[model samples]
Target chain A: MTRLLPVLTVLLAIVALWYAAVAPMNIRQALDMAERGGAVVVPEGSRVRSETSVWTLMAQNTGEIARGYALDRPRLPTPVQVGAELWKTTGEMALRGRAFSTRSLIYHGWITLQSTLFGFALGTAIGILGAVGIVYSRTMEMSVMPWAIISQTVPIVALAPMIIVLSSQLGIEERAVPKAIISAYLCFFPVLVGMVKGLRSPSREQLDLLRTYNAGGFASFLKLRLPASVPYLFTSLKIGVAAALVGTIVGELPTGAISGLGARILIGDQFGTPLAIWAALFAAAILAGALVTLIGWLQGLAMRRMGVRA
Target chain B: MDIEDVVVASDLSLTFKTADGPVHALKDVNLTINKGDFVSFIGPSGCGKTTFLRCVAALEMPTGGTLTVNGMSPDAARKARAYGYVFQAAGLYPWRTIAGNIRLPLEIMGYSKAEMGERVDRVLELVELSGFGGKFPWQLSGGMQQRASIARALAFDADILLMDEPFGALDEIVRDRLNEELLSLWDRTGKTIGFVTHSIPEAVYLSTKIVVMSPRPGRITDVIESPLPKERPLDIRDSREFIEVAHRVRDGLRAGHGDEL
Candidate 1:
């Protein structure tokens, strides 16, 4: 991390230069025609700008801006305009119930979180049980494993609407179970693969040692295999939680409802509220980060309990 | 406990069929271990010595003959908890503390908690590892870890012990000291032991009887009774009697390695 600091700074400097350079060329070219014989090189309907600011340059730098104004786009939004939008939209949303209250985001976020937690729980149990079955039985390894892979191959986003509609037909619409099922579908495969590998991870020499003790299959698993698998299981669980959250949000989109991060985005688009969209996106990300961190904490606790050298 | 024949293997043999054909691992291997006998099996690599020890410990099935311990089949004897085994490597569970590892067999055998506590202390002290019980296996040196493994084998006070090159990975100094200590412990506890090694000097120094094995279709080459006195010390290696037995084991190994020339 110490060595990464200079690299990050260099990257930031390059980004800043690119932000400063691109729009100046667009704005300079736009006004160059108004100066003398310079034909309006930029197409009509492209926003006409007077002066180029460093921050505004970033927004206008897209190649589409160079072609004559046919590709009509908003002029580089001044930082003040963005800031003003952030304040007004956030302020109105906050003041809906009380001053500085984000009741809408809170309620919708709670709904999404409920679905994520439910889905994550379901997925973890299914994955662990599936992995155990696969490792212990040849029939499961041959039959269930291929089906698990096939299930993952179907794009979940494409299946989300079908799942939602089917679940509504089956009367799970108001229960959050549909979103949870979708989350479970997305989160289980990694945990399943990781756990099977972890359970079977102990070396052959170790197994022979256990055999020397006359330990049976169950005793061997309890004494050695289970303890050895703690690290891999927890790592997969953390990743599974994040996937569960993403799946829940995707699940919300198919439902076409007004809740969760997905719902917030939909509402923002319906009302032309970019501020709402950005705030909702930030909130969803923060939620996912929090859930993943929680699993990481659980992982540390589990490894310590198993007496494994971290 | 009365001192008597602790193990008797009668014409034991093992074979397995592989992709190529049937492979014979051990042939007509027979040995007897009486109480307090520190019997050593010495041979070159691929001599099937380790496999023979595993058979006595009930870890492998003998395809041809019977292995009896105190007049019971190895499988029944194992269920009766008649012996403890130490492997070529320590094989200590990295997740367990040394004390916990020592108690594993006791735990499986349903020994009382108090009994386990007492036996853990006794064996740890026997191996001169009195204060190292709480440390995890990974935290210990190779020699110390092997010592812990030996202590684990002795934890239940079984009548017989099987060790497969248990100290082969240790330094010479540690190995010599451990051999002396092991002999003293045997004399004190009167536990019959079957030890396997490849070093001629180690075999000559440690054994009451040595069963030499030949490879490539492993079979017994010779069973030589050591001429060294029942009592052994560090200086025994310098004694004339020790050198005679060492030379005999060397000749036995040569014949086993297929260099009659």
Candidate 2:
């Protein structure tokens, strides 16, 4: 709850900014557009035309002025028009299920969320296990680690489409599996490096204490190594979740047909109405922020339970 | 009990396999510590005093020689929960509360829940930390932390205690208080103690027997028996007998210094 305060404050500020800048300005832009018979005109060298509201003024140009307005450029969405459109669309697309309803966003969001979680979990597990394996065994360090580093350098963004096609070719028919795999690919590296560092975090002196107690391999690892890794694990998991979300979003962008927030975004994007695109983008941002906040809360709870202050 | 000697080290030797060379840390060292014996081993920096204590605690294995306490090897003795070791640092688990830190060995040794609670209470009281069980290690002064660590070791009710410069990290006033408290605790419980310290005054103030040693291939130089009365006062340090023994320890150290080369 304490953590939510800052986020809420930031959100309120953004809302205020929208009210101040986009809300009134976009309404004025729309009014001016409607006034000028839906074509914008910028009276030359007007100081008001030179500010951030320049885009709004440019839409007022007869044909060839302002940054975003042109005979060809997509219209700058006024705050009122977007708000009204958002309200109307929420009624049509979200609340009442008109064209491209928010119910679809919810459904796609659920699918994306499930894949993100699964992929993040799978990646963290793999990374932790791999880190443990590498830390304990010099042989694995020589043989497996370099290849793992090399694997990450390959552009997963480019390979995601190939992975989808390849998964089908191999008769792995799960629709979300390919996307989840790509998310997994994005997540595991941070976990790998972070877990390795965490697992090895126990100082030489702490290990010496265990040694004095005759604590053998597994005993020392469980009592000391594992507990120490917790903070690192949660931190990595937070990063991993964000990366997984990114990977899933990226995965959706390439396919252009899958069911996800990302797919919804791509669909809304091509239509040229910034409101639809902005809504999708805003929803995705909210989801990522919430997910990160959840991980952060867990981190605090675990650290507190372990008697760690921070 | 035919033998009240709780610790017996015979011809102990250790050679470390270092990259630079085989470092001979200890050679043919022998010592016997009886029940309630406050024995301190003091030496130069690279001397085997700490190493010897470690060997006795089974933290380090001897390259040669046999060591036992209460007729058992240190490792076997440790498994039986026979000794509490206080390291140079408090070695308190930073994440555990004071009482929780004290309870660690008891937990490891598998005491009943009730027994563990009783034991923790007693040790916390023993160290004069009657009400500080909930505080973390960082919250305490260095002396208090070390005392808490000693309390942790004392919680086990082991027949033997090993302390490696436990007071070395403390300032003078706290160290003096702890030394007095330790002596009183020793007088009360009759637990055999094997302590390692570099501080001359600490050794003189605490030990029944001081084993003086020196560096290059470390070896015991002299075993000085302190004759100060059992009922020690802070002013006892100013006594002639105490002064004599302190002088003897200094001379022995000087001799050991010469013997090193």
Candidate 3:
């Protein structure tokens, strides 16, 4: 409980700041809306409102500041508005057994999760294979390592659309495939670097001990290197899963997908519903937190079974 | 080489070609370790004692001279699994239980599951770690961890055991206790042992033969054949014969250092 106090405090501070920022951010729009409704707002012209400082306008119209929190299209959604939208989309829908409905965040979250998990698995497999090759062969280390690093440098935002177009041209019917590929592309680098470091983590004395047993290359690897890399692999996996989610979300952006949290965010932006975007963003955060926490729990379980101390 | 000779090194030399210059880690060192013999190499730091042991285990290549273990080259003998080596540190895998660490070599060598279990149990009992086999290395004390490492080396039933300062890191009380346990272990197993240390009393207490050496173009200065009895106790360190052997080793070390000063 004591450990949780600091985190709770920081979260409270952030929420307070978010609530405070809402008034200033949406004040101009709120005043303009009030003027159109026939209320006499000081410095009523939209052009004057844009030119004047939001803080000064806010003080001049204290009565109008509360309207900022109730705007139809807020620049920054209030915490209560976001919380209400999140609950309506997720909790309320879940309670009504409509959690998987088209409008539900859970439905969109499940879509994003499928691609994220698929891409995570693909990236992990490629990463482990690449690490093994790099560790065993000098040629792979020299050839593949540079390209792996270079692959990460090409911005995923730019690459996502190309991948989508390329896969579609290749006659792939599944939209998830291109998204998974882009997700895998972003996640594989961390796994590769981490596994390479992990596979080489055994000490000279440990290697020498294996050598004394006359253990062959494969035997040594199975007995020593593979087991040694587990802790490192898990550490990389946490990072990889989070990156995969980001890649899936970015991939969702350019494709104009009709479902998924990323689509909700894009659609909310296009249709001028900041509340929908805020809800989807929070849902994405919750999903990322769940995925990372799940991996952490697995890591603890594996280490315990392997006889490693915490 | 004699029929009983387990390791025979004549004019064995190892020169490490560092970027700074060539370092003569071992210089024309000559020695013979026979079957069932406990030979300890004692010297100050940089004295090639550990290097020589590494050479016998085929972990290092000798630059010059003929060196053989069980009548074959060190590398060939290594492939035949003729020896088990214990390093200065326990070097047990943290991810494995004590029994599991002992089972590592047996698994690599493709021993049957039942036989591996039997060997692990036997070696754990031999090292007085019978019921603690399921415990991780970190859970055991340093002395127990080293004993478990010894058990690991013994599990394979190799005829030769090469230990490089296996107890160098322990406190004196722990070191003394482990030394006594090790001597009894050596007496029971009758394995040809190559031990390395810097402590004069440790070398005197542990070996049938103590090879004294010096650093800087590292080479042997003396080979003392101990006259101590096979059945010895920890109190033997205070005995006249033990002190005499230790004194000679000290003198040999001083003589090796004579040219340096």
lDDT per residue (tens digit) for residues A61-169 in model 1: 4443443221122133323343454555445566665433444566677888999999999999999999989988999999999999999999998998888888889
Instruction: State how far residue A203 of model 1 sits from its true place (Å).
Output: 2.4
Model 1 spans > 4 angstroms off: A1-41, A46-103, A269-275, A305-310, B1-3, B259-261
Tens digit per residue, CA lDDT, model 2, A239-259: 889999988887887785557
lDDT of 3 at A21: 92
Instruction: Give the TM-score between model 3's chain B and the true chain B.
Output: 0.99
Alpha carbon deviation, residue A157, candidate 2 (Å): 1.4
Candidate 2 residues lying further than 4 Å off, grouped into runs, are A1-94, A97-104, A138-144, A268-278, B259-261
Q: Write the per-residue lDDT of candidate 3 for residues A1-310, one digit (tens) a residue.
A: 7879999999999999989999899999999999999998888799988889998999899999999889867989888888999999999999999999999999999999999999999998999999999999999999999999999999999999999999999999798999899899988989999999999999999999999999999998998999999999999999999999999999899896888889999999999998999999999999999999999999999999998777
Model 3, which residues run further than 4 Å from truth?
A: none
For each candidate in turn, the TM-score is 0.85, 0.83, 0.98
Write the candidate numbers in order of decreasing TM-score.
3, 1, 2
TM-score of chain A of each: 0.74, 0.76, 0.97
- List, residue by residue over B162-238, the lDDT tens digit for candidate 2: 89888887788988999999999999888889889988888998889999998878888999888887888778889
Clashing pairs in 3: none
